[model samples]
Target: METAPVPAFSELISGTQRSAVHLEMRDVYDPGSRRFASWRSGHRENPANRDEWWNPFHSVIAEAVARGVQVRRARVVSEPVSDYVQFEYDVTFSNIAAGEQVRWLPRRRASDLALPGNDFWVFDGRLVRLSHFGGNGEFVQDEMTENPAVVKLCVEAFERVWERAVDHHDYRPA
Candidate 1:
């Protein structure tokens, strides 16, 4: 049997009424992405050239925030972060500039928290979209669910992380 297509993240974000929270638990992701490759080579995103690095994903987020939808992202990472995580930390200012509230939680601080196996987005506390990736940090597939129990789990996990995470502006990578 064929599996149903996963809904676009933008679509889900656009449909949100009040809030959209994203939880990223990986130290590395999407190594094939141009931005990641650029960071790997020592090129960093310049705030002055915002348009050069901005994309539709950012637009969706900006739009959501403009419409009174609170967009927050919490990342749980290991101390002495991986190169990719450091890259992500350096570039997160773009996300902040786009009106996203970002936080970082050290993995050690999350030892007692029960987090989902995959990174996910909980939109309006009603839908959950889990992101799957390959061992090499390649995109694999997305799994979306509206099951109340799963949504509740995601929401709770995100809240616990957010509560313990440090504000992006205050966090300094180890």
Candidate 2:
């Protein structure tokens, strides 16, 4: 009897032999300056406004790439390259093949900014896990994944939004 492969997020980032790591950061806009209060309406009510809060999306990415993660940035709507979905999977798979790390940030329209479904784990570029974040910085929903069909659906939604977005690097926080 053949055994079904257990899907793992780290496996995708670490490549086959563990020599390189590839990562893709897909977001509707640059998150460096996006305040939690604005992103999360709940936060707006309490209004703590820490002020110095930094989005881990960028900093963690910088650290990983600086530590040798091959990072790629793309939008879902990018032309001359209509295969944003394929591009994302390829990036994830290739990075995993190189033993590198990959991260994805897909924006969803929801009331809470910290919502987890905004993120995903793709192995070597293939979808592995689907997760959602809630209002309190917690995983609101988590599904054990690695099903290709499921991954395609998620990636498709990401591409749709990516196509309409401007590049992540175009913005600079004032």
Point to the candidate with the largest lDDT. Answer: 1
Tell me the TM-score of each prediction against the true structure. 0.95, 0.37
RMSD of model 2 against the true structure: 12.3
Candidate 2 yields a Cα-based lDDT of: 0.38
Candidate 2 has what TM-score?
Answer: 0.37
Question: How many clashing pairs per prediction, in order?
Answer: 0, 26
Best by TM-score: 1
